[model samples]
Structure formats: C-alpha cells, structure tokens
Target chain A: MATAKDRAQAKAGSGLNDDIGEQKRLELYRTQVVLREAEQRAYDLFLQNLVKGTSHLSLGQEAVAAGFAGAMKPGDLSFCTYRGHAHTLARGVPVEKVLGELMQRDNGLMRGKGGSMHLTSVDHGVMGSYAIIGAHLPIACGAAWRAQYKGDKDVSVCFFGDGTTNIGAFHEALNFAAVWKLPVIFVCENNLYMEYTPIGDVTAVPQPAADRASAYGLERILIDGNDADVVYRAAQIAFDKARAGEGPSLIECLTYRQSGHSRADPAKYRPEGELDRWKLRDPIKIYRERLLQFGVAERVIADIDAQVRKVVDDATEACKAAPPPPLDIIATDVYADGGWAWRN
Target chain B: MAELTYRDAVIRGIAQEMSRDPDVVFLGEDVAKAGGVFKATVGLYEQFGPLRVRDTPISEQAILGAAMGAAMTGLKPIAEIMFSDFFAVCFDYIANEFPKSRYMSNGQVKCPLVVRTGNGAGSRFGAQHSQSVENWCMMIPGLKVVAPSNPRDVIGLLAASVRDPDPVIFLEHKSLYPTKGEVPDGEIVDTLGTAKVLRSGKDATICALALMVPRALEAAEKLKAKHGIDCEVVDVRSLVPLDTQTILGSVARTHRLFTVEENPRLCGWGAEIVSIVADEAFYDLDGPPVRITTPHIPLPAADILEDIVLPTPDRIAETVRRSLQS
Candidate 1:
C-alpha cells in the first residue's frame, strides 16, 4: 500500500523534478538532522540541570524553520518566537554558541545575558527571538520598513505560531505592512497548540493566515508544514514577491509539535494516540526515507548522521566546560552608553 | 539665532538630523501629507520624500514597535504618537520591547529611537487626550524622558535625542507649538539628563518641567517683587537621569525646594523629585519640600473648570509664600 509520503512526493515531485536534486535533498536532510540532534541534546542538558530556565523545543516543527530560514538572503532578517532553537540554528548559528548561550556561559551568543528564549545573532541577520508571543510581528515589519526606506532588496521573514494570529499586534503588523507594501514575509508555523490549549479552542477563525491576512489585502498561502519542499517553494514565491516590491505575504505551515510546549510542561492534555500518530509522520524519518528514494547512497546518509552526532556531542561538552559570565559585567549591557543600572 | 515657532523648531531639528544622517527616518499617522496634528513635523515629508517621511496607520503599537525594530537595524527612527494619552494603547512596546531589547541582546543591538508626542492639557481635548503621563515612563529604567518648554530647547533636545544611543520619549506640549521664540539655526545639541536654571535667586529653589517652567518663572517674578522672596527656577528638562548635582547645588544655595507640574499630585514626577531631595539632599534643605500639582482628578473639557484644576502662577506664588513662611 502506498503511504501518504509516497502520494505527496508523487503529486509534489512529479515530472517537475526541477524541485531539488539529490545534492540539495541530502543538504536539507543533513540540516534537519543536525537541528533535531542539537535540540535533543539541549533537552538532555536541561534535564541534567545545566541549562537554566525553561526551553521551548521545536521537536517536530523543524521543516518550517529549515525551509524558511534557509531560503532567506544573507542580508535579510529573520525574527522568531520563544520556540526558536531550530530557527536560530537553521540561520547558521554555530552549535557550540547556541549550546553555550543555553547554558548562560561567558562565550554565549549574547554574552550569557540572553538564554534559550532570547537567542539572537545580528551578524547572521537573526534578529533577537522574543519571549512575548506576536510581539515580534511589528518589529519584523519595522526591519522590512527600514529595507524599503533604504531601497534595499533585502526581505525580512517573521516566524510565529498559530497562537500569535489572535493577538492585536498580529493584526496591526499585517495592516501596516500591507499599507506600506513593505518587503516582509510572515510565516505562521501552526503546530496545533498555543502552549497547552488547542489552537482551534483559542483562535476565532479556522484558517488563521488566510482569514487574517486577506483582510489586510496581503497575499496568503497555506501549505503542508511537514513537507520541507512544500514550505521551501511557498517561501521562495513569497520572497520573490517581496523582493519585486509586491509587499508582504503570509504562508501558514500546518505542522505539529511532537514535544510539550516547554521543558516543564508534560502535555498530558494531548488526546490518546496523538503522539504515536505524529511520530509515524516525523519530519526527519519521512525526509530520510525520501532522500534514500531520491538515489542518495546509504553511506552518505550514515556519514551525515555521524557528523551531526559528533557536532552536538562536542558542542554540548564545550558548553558544559565553559564558565558563567562575570559578576562585575552584570550591569554593563543594560544600556548602550552604560549609564542605566539596576538600583536597589 | 533665528526666530522660529516651537512647531518649526521641531521640524528643523528633525530635518537637520535627517539631512546629516541617512539612517534617520520619520513615521507616524498624519506625519507625511498631513504634516502632523500639531504641525511639528510640517515640511518634512516634502523635504525627505515618502520613503524617509512615512505616514503610518493609526496603530500606536505598530508605530512604536517599528521604531524599536528600525532603530535596532541601523536606523534612527523618530515616531510620533499623536497624543501622550494614546501611549496607554502601546505601553507594552515602550515598557517592554524598546527598552529591554538592548539589554536582552547583551548590548549587541542599539535602539536609537525617539517617540515624539504632543502632551499637556490646555487644548480642552478632555480626559482621554489630556493626561500628562510622562511620569508613568520615568519609572522604567532603560528609557530617557525629556520635555522641552521653548523653541530653543526643543531644537537642542530633539537633536540630542536623535543622536542618543538609546530610546528617548520626547514630549512637546500642545500649547507651546505655535508659540514663537528665538532658536539657533546652527547645531544646538544639548546633553541628555541635564537641567537648566532658568532664573537665579537666593531664597527658594523652584523646579518645574514642560509648560510649568514658564509659569514657574512668572511665579518667581511675583514672589520677588510682591513678597520680597527671591526664588530660583530650575527647568528639569530631562527626567530619567535626574540631574542630582545641579538640583542639589540649587537647593544648597537657596535652602528651600519646591516642585511644580500639571499632572496629578499622587505619584507624579514631583513626587519623585521630592523623594530624591529627601533622600540625598535632606541636610541641605532648610524647610520641608513642597509640590504644587493638579489635584487627583481627570481633566475637564471646560476651560474655566480646567483652569482651576491645573496649577497656575497664582497658585505657585501662594505655595512659594506659604513654604517661605515655614
């Protein structure tokens, strides 16, 4: 019996074989594996009491993050929500630095100030990840506005969850972005849940992206978030439109989070058999099988898996050995000029 | 120096910074074709064109959020929220996003943002639009709050605010927009968090901000001529980094301290000033500090009732005389 993956490949990858060749498939497969392993390692460290605070893992939502972040230009900006580990890693931040930041070490990306929820790298065009849901939407529009103001061809991509569409900032950001025709793409990774409650329970509209974005006069598209190629194609179309000065587009990727919302959440509210069902369609498993069918040698897949394991292991070891940030420097980064301090 | 209205001074200050730095951009409702409700941003849209001087939607959340976003991404954005009271709608961005972004990112990003708004209560805009909520922002640690009284100071403070490497809430009183004064045409950049002594006297120290600065000077004149009490008036232009040295110096010389503002008396900027004096300059003060502020009530639309509700020169003079008696 042909599975859903086979049917999706037949329809999405038919004779239009120009989608992506064997080499690109292997690259995407490697990136997806690296992100999966790194996230798992980070979780293991958290369980060991090395990573401070809570961690929001994108366990099963790797396809959307990889597709969107990989499609961006080097100068283009990408903003993420608290479930941002996969997004930041996909933006080319080194595994060691990400682990270091998660551990709050001196050599972290933000010098130990920002933990897992606030990871950012300006050099990689990865704007800071916001802890507040939907708050980063307008900020992403601002970056796009800056790009438009300077007549630059760069586009900004904002990655948020299904829960964000219900907030006022989401509406305001879409309205302003459409009015100005700013170069931005808003990607809604609909993982079916807003923390604990199902998205359908909290959201007013059934199709959040199409329903909300159409009102703002923005071009909206819904795609299968579990399929990397589908997300990549949708993102390319949106990015091309934005670069052509056609304003912003909304791409809603329908995916699911395999893990709980945060480290502390057990997600016992998940209905029976839901986890087992999603585990069968795990993005890594499906993509790995697809890469094999695409004629990539088994040795290449094995080599990639080994390489990812070594990278995650070494990065975790380094982060654990790193020291915490100095106490004297605690009050230094509050302001740019060093005037403001935490007064007693 | 050239004669320019307070509104034009704001325009000139912004225009000058816009011309000097390519990264400076302006965006707000009615800022482009409408030239701002108070005309403070007049002629800017025409001078810099649409890309630089943008007319945004009436979403204070997006306006302020975009300012912080653009500021972090190598742009100095000056966003105008039409009225100070409207800040309540977007206080989350001001209180959380803009001020904490730099700190949260561990100094990797700089938010050189200036949110210019028309403040104060003389226009009969009523309670919804007439509240002086600058004190609400003063409690936040990462933001700089400044309110300028005259055209000259507006020019200097606006320029400095644009150049500062942080977020500044620039307050311009609605009534002072059309008032004309001599302003310098050349660069007139003033330091942030500094106070200027408008009048020098030896008997009592009068500290005020925004529109109250002029009323404080008037009260000082009446106190000296009619009551034989010499009062020194200090315009605390900047509120966040309170200039304790200048304020303490004036208190040491005059031995008496009095604060005047148009906001409600409870938990206003005056309260912060009085507490600071009592904490740091207690020994230098000869008498207990006095604060003359509006009573704890919403501003009314009627001019007669509003006049009685807000502070006035007579009330300031009477407060000074009463304080001198102690």
Candidate 2:
C-alpha cells in the first residue's frame, strides 16, 4: 500500500522535490530523534526530582521546531514560547546546556537564571523563550524592524501556541509587523489544546492564526506540522519571502502534544483515545519510515537513533554532576551595570 | 545661556542624542508628523527623517515591545507612551519584560531603551490623561526613573537617560512644557541618581520632583518672607537610583523635612523619602516630617476642583508655617 510519504515523494514538480536532498532529509530525521530523546530524558529527570520547578515540554511537537530551526540561516533570530526545549536543541544549543538549565546548575545556558521557560542563547540566534503567551510576537517584530532599519538580510522567526492568538498583543504585533513590512514569520503551532482546553472552544474562528492573516494583509498559510518535510518547506518559503522584503507571513502548523501540557498536568481533560490516536502518527515514527523509502539504509537510521540516545545520556550525567548556581548569583544581572542598586 | 521652554528642551535633548548616535531611534503615536500630543517633540521628524523618527499605531504593547526588541539587538530606542496613565495599558512590558529581561537572562540580553511619557496633572485632561505616576515606575526594581522640572535639567537629564545602558522611564510634566528657564549653550549632559539643591537654607528641607519642584521653590520664598522659616529646596531628578544622600544631607542641616508632591497621598514618592529619612536620619529631625500632597482621590476635570486638589505654593507655605509653629 502506498503511504502518504510515498505520494508526497512521487509528486515530481511539488516543493517537496526541491533542494531538501537525502542529506537534509537525514538531518531532519536526526533532529527529531534528538529532540524526542532529550525531551524523554527531561521527563525522566523531572520524575527523579533532578529538574526543579515547572516545565512545559514539546514531546510530540518536535517536527515544527526541527523543521523551522533547520530551515533557518546562521543569523536568523528565533523567538519561541515556554514549550521550547525542542526549539533550543534544534538551534544547535548544546543539550547539556539546556539540561543543565533545567537542572538549575552552574553550567546552564543562563547559569541557572532563566530556567526552562526563558531559554536564551544569542550566540545560537534563539532570541528568547517567552513564558508570557503573546508578548514575544511584537518583540520579534522589533528585531525584524531592526534588521529592516539596518538593511540586514536576517529574518526573525517567532513561534507561539494557538492560545496566543486570543491575546491582545498578538493582534497588535501582527498589525504592526505587517504595516512596517517587517522581515518576520509568525509561526503558530496549533497543538489543538491551549493548555487543558481545546483551541477551537475559545477561538472565534476555526483556524485562529490563518483566518486572521487577511486582517494584517498577510497571506494565509496552514500546513501539516506533524510532517517534518512539510514544515521545512513552508519555513524555507516564508524565510525567503521575508528576506525578499515581501513583509511578514503567518503560518499555522497543525500538530499535537503527546504528553500533558506540563509535568504537573495529567491531561485528564482530554477526550478518550485522543492521545492514543495521535501516537500512531508520531513525528519521529513518520520521519523514520520516510527515510527508509528514500533508500537510506536501515543501519544508518539505527546509528542515528543510537547517537541520539548517547547524546541524551551524556547530557543527563553532566546535568546530575553539575552544581547549583552560587548564592552570589541571586543579586547579580538586575541591570546593565551588573548591580541591583536602585538607590545610593 | 539661552532661554528655552521645557518643551523645546525636550526637543533639544532628543535631537542631541539622535544626532550624536546613529543607533538612537525615536517612535510613538503621532510623534512624527503630528509632533507628539504635547508638542514636546516638534521638530524630531523633520530633523531625523521618517526611518529613524518613525510613527506607530495606538498599540502601546507593540510600541514598547518593539522598543525592547530593538534595544536588545543593537539600536537605542526612545518610545513615547503619550501619557503616564497609559502605563496601565502596557505595564507588562514595563513591569515584567524590560526590567526582568536582564535579570532573568542573567545579563545575556540588555534593554538599552527609554520610555518617555507625558506625566502629572495641570492641563485639565482629567483623571485618565493627567496623572503623576512616577511612583508606578519607582517600585519596579530594574527600571531607572527620571522627572525633570526645569528646561536645563530636561536637556541634561534626558541626554543622560539616552546614554544609560539600562531601561529608563523619562517622565516629562505636561504642565511645565510652556514654562521657560535658562539652558546653557553647547552640548549639555547630566548624570542620573543625582539631586540638585536649588536653594540652601538652615531651618527646613523641602524635597520635590517635576512640577512640584517649582512649587516648592515658590513656597520656600513665601515661607522666608511670611514666617521667617528658611527652607532648602531639592529637585529629586531621579527616583529609582534615588539621591538619598543629597536629601538626607539637606535634612541633616535643616533639622526639619517636608516633601511637596503632586501625586496622591497614598504611597506617593514622598512617602518613600519619608520612610528613608526616618530609617537613616532619625537623629537629625527636630520635628515630625510632613508631606504636602493631593488628597487620595481621583483628579477631577473642573478647574476649581483640580486647582484645589493639586499642591499649590500657598498651601505648601501654609503647611510648613503651621507645622513649624506648632
């Protein structure tokens, strides 16, 4: 029986047949495998009490992060939501740094200051991971505005959940970015649920982000976020459009979260069979099958899986051995001068 | 020195910074073609051109968010919030995003931006438009707050704010825009967290900010003539990096402390000063510290009601006279 991947690959003239060769396909598969293994390790660490505080996981939403981050150039900026472990790892941020941050260690990306929700690595072009739902949309616009003002060819990509579409900042940012012709791409990963509730229950329109694209004078783009190839192709076109000075594009990627929203959520609110049904179409599973049909050897796929497991295992050991940030770190970095003194 | 209005000083301050640094950019609602609602930024658009001196929509969140984004990257942005009262509309950016970014990111990100807003009540814009909300910004830990009373301080302090590496909330009194004062010729710059003692006296220390500074100075003159109580008046230019040294020194010499404030009585900037004085300079007090402030009520639109609500020179002098005599 011909699968969806077979049909997609057989379409000779489609965008799927473009420059995303066997090497890039294998790379996309590797990214998803790494994200999956790393996130699974994080979940286990949380259970072992190694990861402190609250964390939002992107267990099933790896394809969107992997696809978008893979499509981006070196200088392109990425702004994502609190559910950003996958995005950070996909951006080439060391797994140990991410895991160390989650473990609240001295070796963390922010030296244990930002924690999981606010991961930032300017060196990797991951601008920030905003816990506030829709705040970074306008911030991403500002970064894009800077690029436009400086005549730089860098595009700013912002990722948020379906829930962010309801916030006032989301609308304001969309309008502002469109009016200024900013080099930005607003990617909404519609995981069906905005926290515990389904997005359709609260949203005014069926497709929250895509339906409102016309309001901001943008082209409506909706894609299957579960497929890495689809997301990667869409991301490339959007980046090209933004870099060409054609203004912003709002892309809604339809995907799902395999786990609960956070470690605290059991997701009791979900309908029966929902999680089980989505599990069959898992992003990693689909990509692995696609790689086989493309004539990539079975041992090659196994080697990638083994490599990802080793990376995750090494990161976990390093995070466990790392020490907590020192007490002096508490009062530091409040201002640009590296002091918290508000008064003489 | 040339005589300049507090409004023109705003123009000069911004022009000076924008001209000196190509990275400095300005944006707000109607700030470009309309020259700001208060007319404080009259010639910036014409001088800097559209790209650098752009205008924005009525989205306060977008305005400040974009400013933060730009500031974090490379450019130095001066965003106008129109009125200080609208800080309520975009308090998340001020209270959460800008102040917490550096601390949360552990200094990986820097927000080098200034949010200049028209503040205080005198134009009869009523409760919504006219408000002395400097205290709203003062409580936030990472923000630097500045409110200048005279034209000279306006030019100098604004230049300092633009150059500062952190986020600054620049409060310009709407009522003082038309008021004139002598401004020194050539490039003028000043420091943050410094208080200027306008008059030195031996009997009482009067500390004020923004619109209240001129009122406090006037009250000092009236007190000396009517009651023979000489008052030292200090202009508290910056609130976050507060000049407690100057204020405490003045209190130490005079042995009496008074604060003339335009904000409402509840949790005003004056209250903080009083608390600081009580904690550090209790031995210097000859009498209880007195705060002359507007009663804790929403400012009314009527001329008579508004006039009676805000602190006047007569009321300030009388308050000092009665407090000292008793």
Candidate 3:
C-alpha cells in the first residue's frame, strides 16, 4: 500500500487530472477486499443457520460500494437498497456489528431491531438501507436538500438496482433533485438482474437509469461497475459536481450479482454459464490484479487479504456468541419518546 | 386575543416555528409564491423566502420521502400534501418510511416533522379530492395524528406537532379554513394526546373531530333548546395519542355517548372511540353508544347529495334525540 508521502509525491508528479493517486487506488482495493470477505462470511453464516430471516448479499458487486463510499467525505449521506451489506460495510461500520445484525443479536448495528434489510447507523452517515424499491432515491434527495438548505458542502449518494429505475419514485426523485439542484448522486448498480428476472426483460431502455437521465435533463452516465478505478473516477467527478451545487447526477453502473437475490433464492433461473462468464470479471478479482499491475507490492496485497480474513473470522465468532436481543425491546422506539403506546 | 381565520392560523403557526428554529422548512406543490392551491398558506413564502419555504413539482412520494429524509437528518420539516386524499399516492412514506424509521433503526433516527394536509369534505371537490382520512393516519402506529377544529387549535397544535420528536400528521379541515375563531397572542404551543371539552353538559357526551365539531356543537345547542337535553361536546383533537381519559370522563359524567364522524361508516374514527367507550364505560352508558357518520360511499360533487351523506347538524340532533328517547 502507498504511504501518504508516496501518494502526495505521485499526485505532484502525475499532471493528469483523472489520476486517483496510488493511495486512493489502494484504499478502493482494500474496501473491495473487506466487503467481499465480509459478505462471503455472511453467506457462510446463513448456511450455518446462524443468520436469521433473509439476507441480500452484494457478493460480485463490491466495486460500486467501495468506489462511491471511498469518494464520499465524512458527513456525506448514503442511502441504499436491501442488497446493502457491501454498502454498509464500505461506510466503515465494524464487521462485528453488521454480522451481529444479520444474526439478530444484542450487539447488532441496531441492536437486532432492524435486522438484515434495514441496517442503519446514523453515526456512520449510512442513512438507511430501505427494503422497498426506489423509496430511498427521494430520501437521498431530501438529505441533499437538507445539505443544500444549510449551505453544507456534504452530498448524498443513493444506490439501487436497475429495477428501481422503472419505479415511479425513481422518476419523481430524479425530477425533484434536478429541478431543485439538490446535491445528490443517484447510482444504479445495474447488476444485469432485478431480483429474479433480468433487468432487460422488464426495462424499456437498454441502460435503465442512464437512458432515462435525458428525460430529467441530466447527463447520461454509464460505466463498468466491475472496475473499481473506473467507478472511483466517475464517483469523484459526480461528488465534485454535487458539492459545487451543479445538481444531482444519475450514474448507471453495469455489473452482475454472483449470488441469488436473497438467502431463499436458488438463482436457478439464470441462464447456463452466465455465472461462469461473470466470474471472469469479478470485482474483487479484477481489483487484486489491478493492484499488482500498478506496482503495489505482493506482500501488501497478501497483508490486506490476511487482515480482512481475520476480521471476518473474528466477527463471525463474536456474532455466533452474541445473544438475541431482549424481549423488552420489542415495544421500544415506536415513537421518539422511546415507547410504543399510541393511546393513554 | 384577536380573531383569525383557520387559513391564517396555518400561516401563523408555520411562521412561528420557522422563526423559532432555522431548521424548520416548509414544502409542497404551490405552497410557495402561489400560496398553496387552497390559499391556506398565504404569506408564508414571502415571510420565509424561497429556500425555507419551497414549492415542489406535483410529486407526492417525493414530497413525503424528501420530508422524511430531511427529518431523519437535523431538520424539522413541515410538508403539505395539498389534499389528504393524495396520501394514497405517498402512503408508502406515511405507513412504511416515516413511522417505521425510528423503530426500525432502534431509535437511532428521529423524524421530528409534520405532514399537514387539507382534510375533510364540504367544498364538493368530488370523490378524488374530498376525504376525511385522519382515520387512515390514526390506524398507523408510531404517528401522532392531530385534527384541529378552530383557528386557535390549528396554530397551537401545528406548533406542537412541529416541536414533537415523532412524526405528526396534522389534518387541517378544508371546510373550516375560512371559519373564524379567537386566537390568543404569542407562540401558542399545545400538547398532543389531549382533548378539550368545548361545551360541557350533563345529559350526554357528543364526541367529534375536525368538521364534526362545529356540527356537534350546533346539535348540542338544538338538543338543549328543543328537547331540554344538555349534551357535552368533546373535541377529540389528537387521535393517535388519543385522550381516552377526557373521553371516558365525559362519557362517565353524561352516562351516554354519541360520535359524529365525517369519514365513511365502516372503519371511521368514531368506531374506535365507540369501541373504547363501550369496553371501558359499559356500565356508565344509559343507552347503546351511537355513531352518526357519513354513509360508506364515495362523496359526490353535488352539494345536495354531499350534504345529505355527511353527518349534518339536523341528522346529529335527530339521531341523539331518537336514540335517547328509545
């Protein structure tokens, strides 16, 4: 990994505007590795019956979360869909708390209240992970609106699947964000499939989110989500534009999900060899090779890989030992008073 | 004290909050510059300026979703849904997003916001535009529902709802917008989950909300003058954090209960009140608790049909008179 001094030197030497210094590239690579390992551990926990309810894994789509989260500054908000394990982990939330949430334990991110689909840590600026499709897009716009209203330099980044672009809230939020010039970035992780069906089957346009960008008077942005470098450059540009008060940008990243939509899905509907074909372009695999090609020491790559494995392992053990939340918590937090009583 | 219209009270209430807290923002379609479609929000845009008082495109979901997002952060936003009927379009935010955010996040996120909508029927806006949907909001847990009958209550309760940490659905009656009432000077902030006894009587308890409050008072007056039966009129203001104590006390004193509701008959707000009264104050009741409500049918544009369907003062007086006699 490049040190701060090395990164500064590299930035000084490289006159190219789009060059993300060695430090940033290494940071993105490390984020992808951590997300990938943590997500794989979550899958393993599900297989062991430790994880309760359903879980949505972003196994093959680490680059999108890593790139966007890396580009975002502190106080910037992130709103994502249910397939949000990667996004949550990428925001610097501990692997233990996230895993504990999946296990429905007292040590969970939300103390087992939110469970798998609704992971939220306001302290981390991960606003929420919404279960409903296209719901958080408008919410992200609102957060951006708040930032704009307060004259804060922070931006809001929203993530969703390709299916979300087809939802009514998507168009509503886009037009609202554009007209208001809200500092928000709408990132569509077009992972080929929308739940069980291929996005192309139901979507009217080829690039679901980007093609519809023109309708809202936004720039048409589409990129390869498998490459962390490409995604990082795009995210930085969008973030800069939003912070400069140029309004929201809609970026559709073409990617693929290696796992089924959720724990219950077998993903048998995927065509033969589709998974195999996507495996060649796997985000983590590509990022690791890219790091080596960029002259990052082999020892540095091995060290990060080993460190992430240990983190995931420790989180798994801790989550396995963590007890379920107390029954008394069931009625709490319904209102701001911390009680569920609707009537006297 | 000075007299003010219900519409003017809305502007005053919002202005009071906005002036007090820089974080409080107001948004809706035509709410800014255009002064809202109903003209209930006149002078707010001019007072607060464009950023604080915003007007959005006709997008209900975005309006509500944005409000929830803003609230989840550090802002106390007051979003107008224009008509209460449009809640159907953005029901996801009301039912799923706003109410569930704090609970689902285990108290990490607090949505201290107000969604004020023009509710109830009297303007002959037809089925789509006209609806007394406070009952729709009352059913959802984690929400504070408020429907003020007069200008004073509107300002007081709107102030209260804006200050409340929980999400509040403030229902401003469209019919009562132009009606005038006395409002005390200064920042009038009231409490949620409290009902006021508008007119006290010994014979019977007349429970009402929003549009029904005025009609219930009129019926009470006629019942006292004609039948010599004094009825206590109770304004059931906040529905979610229902002031059951006030209602039960009124029922206990009167020993009879009657609810006048403008919502459809099946699952109206009156039904819940009646059920509670029947269960808790069963022995106190001298007769079966009666509910005078709009028939389970879509409101029509015609004035005659609409007036006949909605619970009127005459119908309320006749129903109370006949029920007491039997």
Candidate 4:
C-alpha cells in the first residue's frame, strides 16, 4: 500500500515522474469520458434506427477499460465479455464502427450481427467476446496454449466483470492455464456491484478478486483501476512476463460503475459518501494537473478532446442514418451447404 | 485385412491421420507421454512429439477449445475426453461455438475438429463416468455424430471425422475397446450418415446404433433361425443428418419397424428417429414400431445392475417380436 508520502516520492523511481503519470492518468480519464458521451450519442441514434437489441456501456467504470487497453501489444489478443464497448474503444476501435454496429450497419465490426457482446477484429488480434460470462477465458487459455505449443511469443488477455469471477469456467480456465504454464492474463474489473447485488453480498472473499489466482500457483496483482498509468505499466509488466513463458497472471482492478449494470436499472442502492469519494479521485483531473505540471500545452489536450468529441458526433450521425440488418438475416448463416451427407 | 481390437484401431487411425496430414494433431489428458489411460494414443507422442500430440490439463473445455481453435486455424485436431460424461463441461462450446462457426462465418471457415469420446453404461464407472452422450450430441444441428459399432468402422469413421468439414462427435463405446474385429485392408473412406444393412430379411426392418447394433443383429439372427421372422437389421452409422431414406425405404418394403439404442427410451435418439420415420412412412407400416433401449435412469456401477439397466439382445428380440405381433 502506497502512502501519500510514498506516492509522492516513489513516482520518481520507476522512470515515471509523478507529473507525467498524473498527466497520462488524466488523459485516459478524459478519453473514457469521451467514450461514455459517444456511447450515449450512439444510444440516441440506436433509438432512431432501432437495429437489434440493447447496448452495454461503461459510463462510470471507464478508467480500468482505458487503463488496461492502453497497455496492450499489437499481437496480444484480448477476450472480453458482454460489457465490452469501453474495452473495444480503449483498444483503439474507432467510434464510427462501434456506433455503426449499434445501428446495425454493414460496416459494423461483425457485420452488425454481433451487436455489442460479440465484438471482434482479428486484424487487431481482438478475439471475439461472448454474452455468456467467463466462456471466452477458456478460449484465451486455448490461444495461449497454442502459442506456447508453437513457441510463439504472443500473450492472451481475458477481461471479465466481478460477477464472472465466480463462474465455474473462470476457475477451470485459471487452474488449467496455471498448470500448463500458458501465457494468459485474467483481469477482474471489480466495479463494486454485480448487476444489482454488491460484491460483498455475492462473494465470500470481497474485493481484490486477483487473490483467487494465487490458489492456482499464479501471481495476483491488484491496483487502483482508475489510474491509467498504473494500469498500463502493470499490464505491460504482466504481459512481458507471460509472453516470456512464465505462466498466467491475475490482475484485479478496483473501480466502480456510474450507471446500472445495463440500460434498464438505475442504481439507487449506492451510498452517496462512497460515490463522492470516488468522484473526488477522478483520474481525469489528476492526469490533467500532472500534464500541466509537465508543461504539456493545454491547447494540445483541448484539441485532442475536441477531436474525440467530433468523431463521436460524426459516429452518432452515421448511426442515425445507417440501415438495420435485413429481415432475412434470421434464416441465413445456420450451416454451410445445409449439411454434409455421410454414406457407406 | 488385419484383425485389430477396437482400441488398437483407434490408435492406428489417429497414427495414420497424423502421418498423412501434417496439420493433423492429437490432444487430451495424458494423450502424450501416458499415451492415454486406455493406450489408445500409444506411441503418438514419440512419433509426432509433444507439440503435435498435446497432453492438456484435465479440463474438458480446454481440451475441446484447443481442438476448436486448432481446427479453425486449418489444423485437423482430434481431442479426447477421458470419459464421455466429461463432455457435459464443454457442451456449450462444442454445441454452440464450434458447430456454429462455419455457418456463422458464412462457410468461410471449416471446423475440422473431432471430439472422440467413449460412451455406454459399463466398466462399473458408476453414474458419473458412464454415460451415453451420443444422443445429446446428435441433437445438435451443425455437429455430425458417429457411433461406431466395430473396429473396422472405428478406423473408417475416425478418419472420416478428421476429413469432414464440420465438427464430429465420434462416440466410441468403452466396452467395445478390446472387442476384436477384422478391419478391411487398404484405405477405408466411408461417408457419414450412411446406414449399412447388416442383415437382410423380408418380415421387418430393425434400426440400431452403437453397441446396440450387434445386439439387434443377434436378435435378428435368433428370430430368423427360430421363429422364421427373418427381420432385417440396419446399423445407423451416423445419428445426425440421419439416413431417413434408407430407414424409411426398408420400412416401406418390410412394413414393420423397430429401433435399438443404448440410451434411455424417453426422448432419446431412438424417439427422434421413430418420429421422423413415423411421419414419413406411417401409412406404409403394417405394425406399430417398437424402441428397445435402456430405461430413463443413470447407469448403475454393479455389473448385475447394469445388465438389468442396459438394453440386452433378449429385450431387443422381445421388442422385435412385439412389433411383428402388433
């Protein structure tokens, strides 16, 4: 645990100046806020176009998504769960395609069939996400297993929520990855609540889900997920170690969700004091102040914000004008050639 | 033609496929150095090395997923589950993901993954280990299900499963592993979903799958030799994409129907076949069809208990007699 004094002094030891890291943190927060705004704009467009189903957004828990995504390598594969739009954006997916998907455009990532839960782009090494919780972890393990078998230096990443940590698949994946020395990383984004129930209410071991990884002979690391610099640096270190064939790592990011789990619920259960404390620890302001301290021109940061906002605006407009998937899409893509005939 | 045991034939088939195609690989628990608990993958690790013959952790999903991933990437991967019951852990991946991938990708990709598992209620493995999961897998749309009755079909079907463009669940019976049979010499490439007439008769058409095929044939022989029933027995080589024409055609000619399956009666694979054949050839039938299968219950561990639970030749003969009487 870094004290106020340690945080002030230790920042200089890791080649990460207190000022630079703070700026990086702020930049990430601002970027996440922009992503949230874009999500809302896309939602409005979805209302007009009404393509498929509901869209999941990371309105409050923006820091961890951006923080972890900023640290990934080009060849590294990321397997996400249902709430994956922020992770997608953080990994550099353009808002246009992201929103275009919400509108069911042919230009969407998965030809609009995936909606949000199944976002993927193999070009970016972004393995497909699934609506089924913790299911993709085994796939990540499999990819890592293949990499190790082929002597490839690639690492696989699995991102899931606190609720998914309890799934049987998650335990199975972690245990297997640990035993086989597979280069896979498990990230548990602990955002206080799982849908409506608080983590404390649901899990016997509260907070720092990474602790569970240690039971499988793997390293478990926990961090303030709101801090982008901390997340990026920690993720980079873990990926480097895993890619070196050291085995799997479990990283639990402590964060909070601003909205309900999805589009339907409004969270009235959170205590005001706890929410206020988190708001005060706003990673955006911290990074902006640090960036100012580092003599980064405010005009440059302002321009970046303006550019992001404009792109989201354009994406919003594009989604509004985009067409939905054809009705006949339901009947197609069931099987190739209907089926194969087997004869003696 | 070499006389090979069922288990030896499987190892030979895997060896042949791995040797024939560099892209073909084997994966399972202890499939490498241990050469499998049943020695079905014997000498594979030494031949192909560990990279090709992988020994994965005791996780059904990981084993199945490795096969799925390898197959999707142009590798013909054969993944073994130590027991058929363990497949329940990865039903979602095999049923939902691998099978649906080709269709979802609009046929751009082929899932050349073979999930080889041993089924049936024997070996005193009790309720947990002993299971007939063929019927469950056959219910899936994109997956091709094969239940081999003998060593010859074991090698032929496994080789075919490796070459098939779709995912195949090759359900081998645990009891049939040491059951020796004469495998036809030379390359055997039998197409899937083709039913072979093991016995030809004039009175009735009897359909059976997996271990029950031999039992049904034995019953058919008894009926012919003793009562002059002369029942024809059909071995349904593949369950999914069933040979409805072959089944219905025989029923159309014989005008009597019977089915034999190792699984439980209610809603088993037999019921589906019965429904399909009934809908197609009901008016052509001279008697009501009968299904000789296990009762709806988990298999017992004791041999005596299992015998009572499993479908026996006497029971199949009785069912065939009742079908003729009806």
Give candidate 3 misplaced runs (Cα > 4 Å).
A1-18
The pairs that clash in candidate 3 are none
Q: B278-310, model 3: which lDDT tens digit per residue?
A: 889899999999989999999999998898999
DockQ of 4: 0.40
Name the top TM-score candidate: 2
Error of 1 at B16 (Å): 2.0
- Give the per-residue lDDT of model 2 (tens digit) for B1-326: 99999999999999999999999999999999999998999989999999999899999999999999999889999999999999998999999899999988888889999999999998888999888998888999899999999999999999999999999999999999999999999999999999999999999999999999999999999999988889999999999799999999999999999998899899999999999999999999999999999999999998889999999999999999999999
* Candidate number that wins on DockQ, 1 or 4: 1
How much does each candidate deviate at the interface, measured as C-alpha RMSD after superposition?
Answer: 2.5, 0.7, 0.7, 3.7
What residue pairs clash in candidate 2, if any at all? none
| Poorest stretch of ten by lDDT in candidate 2 chain B | B101-110
Question: Which candidate number would show the highest DockQ if scored against the true structure?
Answer: 2
Predicted candidate 4 versus true structure: per-residue lDDT over B1-326, tens digit per residue: 88999999988888878889877888888889998887788999999987798877777876776576556544778889888888788887877777665554334445777888878876888898888888788767678889889989998888988887778898988888888999888777677778888888889988988788888888988887777898888998888657888888788788888888778777787787788778878899787777778888888999899888888888878777766765
Ranking by DockQ: 2, 3, 1, 4
Q: Give residue A56's lDDT in candidate 4 (0 to 100).
A: 73
Ranking by TM-score: 2, 3, 1, 4
What tens-digit string does per-residue lDDT give for candidate 1 at B46-68?
99998899998889889998888
Name the regions of candidate 1 deviating beyond 4 angstroms. A1-18, A339-344
